[model samples]
Target: MLQSTTGIERLVLVPSLLRSLLMYLQLQKRKDALACLKLWVCSGETLVVSLAKEFYNYFPENEYKLCNFYGSTEIMGDVTYHVITGMDQLRHQDKVPIGLPIDNTIIYILDSNYRPVKTGEIGELFAAGQNVAAGYVNGRDPEKFVENSLAIDPMFAKLYRTGDFAKLEKGTIFYEGRTDSQIKIRGHRVDLAEIEKAVTSIDGIGKAIVLCYQPGEINQALLAFVLTETNITEHQIEEALRQKLTSYMVPQVIILDSIPLLVNGKIDRQSLLKAYGNVNNNDISFQNGIDYKGVPKDQMHAAIALFETIASVLGKAARSTISIDANFYNIGGNSLNSIFTITALSDRGYHINISDFITAKDLGHILSKLSNDRKNAYLSGQTEHDYTSELLKDEYKEDVLDMITTSFYEKADLEQWLMPNIYVEDYRELIDAIWEPLVDKRLSLVVRAKNGEIHGVALNFDARDEPEVEIKSQLNIVFEFLESIEGPVRDNILPPGKGTVLHSFMMATRSTLTPGENVSIMNFMEDEVLKLAIERQFAGIFTTNTSPLTQQLGSDVYAYETIHDCQVNLYVASDNTKPFAKAPDSQRAKVQWKPV
Candidate 1:
């Protein structure tokens, strides 16, 4: 980050070299970042403390910084996680995050009456940001997005109402558990009450109540609390589940209990916690450590099998072999496979998390990360000394820029990163490229911003050319700016043409950037493009993903067939006699994403 007032900057190294530099920064005593290079050496998911001890030569992390991210499904994936500097607070009492929100994002911990609660009190986490996803559409009900209206902020455009819990820590965010019962373990979300209902419904179970407790001393192994009149052992329950449940849903334990609830009618969970507290996530097979070849070997058959498995699950074709290094997302991996992959790992005795592939370079890297994670889950927390770094106070919490790009047809080997070209100076040259697509029409351009300091410039390119423009214009301004950049736009940005790709030629600020800035510019740009598309009367419609710009579109300009892939995996108790059986399932949402 620019430590001075001058924010404009340039990168001189290649992306690979840049990665090396980043690794160095991460290793610095001051940079509080994890050593990802070291973390990737092994299979990188579902790791346990026991496995790390067995293999400390490879898996060594500062125990003090073992953070656990938490938030809601409605907001972005993570609102807060455990922190290195605050572990002492948690050991004494429940310590939550008071961390800084993401760039251009806001969080409002509101009370039931929709008002701000005291700093230390509990409330729902309400978030607002460009990172927020569109509202859920399972039914006709509008109760989900009703957390509150968008409250404008000085720096960010608006704040979203996250239905999760979070608190401020120093300046970073520390997350508590959710306001409701929604919980995600290793990235797989399951309702405890729902699981209990299913368990009780089984023939022999008289009553059941599922309880989730932090693994602490006397904490039962990561599992389910079952109360059944029939003397069914854990083995019997597990055997029953083998036929009916997906491996990920299985509980590690199925304890016999005489008392199912307390006098207050609540599940007597404290006694259970006291009985088997501090249970580790290691009771599963995936936590035992699995070895995988880092690179996809000449196993044409293995790649084919993987592709087939994924395709069968998603009903897509997999005749093509995916590169071992190819990302699942850039290639169009959706949420279905995201969930399916967890079950897939558990099917193989591997526990995994969603972040493992959030920007995974390729299948090989992900396979490696998953391998490590499995063997290292619930390792000793980071030590306090390790968390006392300058980087914690001021560090660039970087997220890999995984960009994907395509044209007309879907492309495999999804390898696009929206990056800057080495020589681009400004956005104008980028805009100039659009002129090529608009040469035939009497083109007029529109650039948006409050002042002449432009944020976006639209080349009202006319796409309707008879034979196409024979000669490209040297006067193209946008293309020149693009060519001057140190690197071109990363693959993640939209292609030049789209159903309608709306983007600022520059980084649009959360506040300064408004739909009005885009609409007026796009309106004129479309008029010019309409001349190119040869649709003189095409002023009535436009389409794009739901965003500030898209939200600005007239109510009639909406989307349809927004494909959502769904899946429901019935899990079982690994140590139980009749753990999981073919269980009832719920289709969560259509999956989105492909390996880029």
Candidate 2:
């Protein structure tokens, strides 16, 4: 038997090790597991910020210092250490900082130019110390082991550039993201690791991976695959991200049973992309639908229909097993499946939205909400505007102006925009200024309820004729932005001659109706506008806005183009299967036209 005379006070382990010890205690086999330890040091993956509190919560008799060590495999385990105290220290935070550098190790947070970045600014982490590995065996990439001329003697031979994004604050080193983990989505540089950190900060998310799936030439999708411990709605996750990140930074979050890992314990990114495509055939499937098979038969008719719609979208295998209560996420549903399901249901005369499907708890809840919304928001009246005549009539002008004012005022409130004192007449004047130019354009429409109250309005006009200088400048910037992004769809998106912009759209029922109903209104409005654009062969249908919801709700099955900072998104109508089918057959043909 092995024996040691040393009484262990400090315990160094990975998070998995500590979890295993806790599991043993839960089984009642080892109530005093690791009771002799005074300090428990954790390394390897980011230590859960609340691990210290959790340990005490489960085993009140045991008390120990829980330290989270941070470093990479190339740096021989740890470079910094942070001793955690309580959950209060981590409230609203992602993870504990790696803390100050260990003895004999020096860490530098530097920008891309290799200059020291300001404290609290995210930058690549570089290590200069005796503990840093002496370069990879067999001569690997030299970029990682480059020598820094500014380094002092003992550590002069090499300065390891760890690719890890981090920031230093008050002598503590906090991990931010990874340099290699950045992705360019719709011309915006997105850091996937940042998303993962944000997701893990949420209460119930066990782990998360932000993955980019580039299926082919044009379709690039960013999806968040997460391991959640408790039931959470997608909207809740989205709302949390909305508070911490820009709208463009929020990726679609998909809950999973577990994160797929490689044999060596690192994330299997390829597997995640594969599962994203074939969501039905993954390890995350709803317990193979065994629980679903046992559901009661007397569920509501709407619930049955919703379940069938989900099952049909998931494919043939799911039709028999997916119960009325089965979650779309657990039963092989994904974003792609969701789009198809909603489209199919719409064809079946059941209007719904992707947001509605993802936010609901289950089929029963969604059906109940859907039933209620339809009864309350039923379309009672309609006045389709004929652009050939006066588009904005005197009778409808007040209600239209009211819708615009209310919507814009709400936006102003949310953004905290300080504007000059403005009344209803001021709003009416601006609306009139934009409305006069649409004298003969068939691109404006309004829908009203039976009470002769306007419930919806869609306004589109030639930006070239806009009277306001601010509006013209914005449209000019949007045109330039679209022309800048090079892709097969660029030609189709570039303003042909004069740009036709859909500047304003809002449903009065937006405040009262469910997301599904609002989406229905949006879809109707977009369809009407797109038909007008197609009939006229207008340059491009675009909207200038900062909100991502505008594009998400409007660009259904359409080829979408966006210029990130400008908040200009152009939606071009085409076959969903081949969004850029109208583009030139070959790049050579376009370059051939250019004068050399």
Task: Specify the highest-lDDT model's number.
Answer: 2
Model 2 agreement with the true structure over 1-596: per-residue lDDT tens digits: 12222587787776755765664566665545555666788887767665555676665322556788888878887888887655555666656788888888888888756789998888889988888887888878777987776676755456899888889887788987677776544334467877777877788876677887662122345677876767887658867887887554667677777666667556678998887667554433222343434334553555556665665555422322465466665444433345566556655656544445556567665554453343232231123422121244557777677666665543321111112123345556556666655434545777654455556677766534444423332223323333343332324644444643333323332333333334445555655666666666664565543333443333333334443332112323222232223223321111001000
Top TM-score prediction, candidate number: 2
Residue ranges of candidate 1 with Cα displaced over 4 Å: 1-67, 71-73, 81-99, 138-140, 147-150, 154-161, 167-174, 182-223, 226-596
TM-scores for all candidates: the values are 0.24, 0.48
Q: Which residue pairs in candidate 2 collide? A: none
Q: What is the C-alpha local distance difference test score of each model?
A: 0.36, 0.56
lDDT score for candidate 2 against the true structure: 0.56
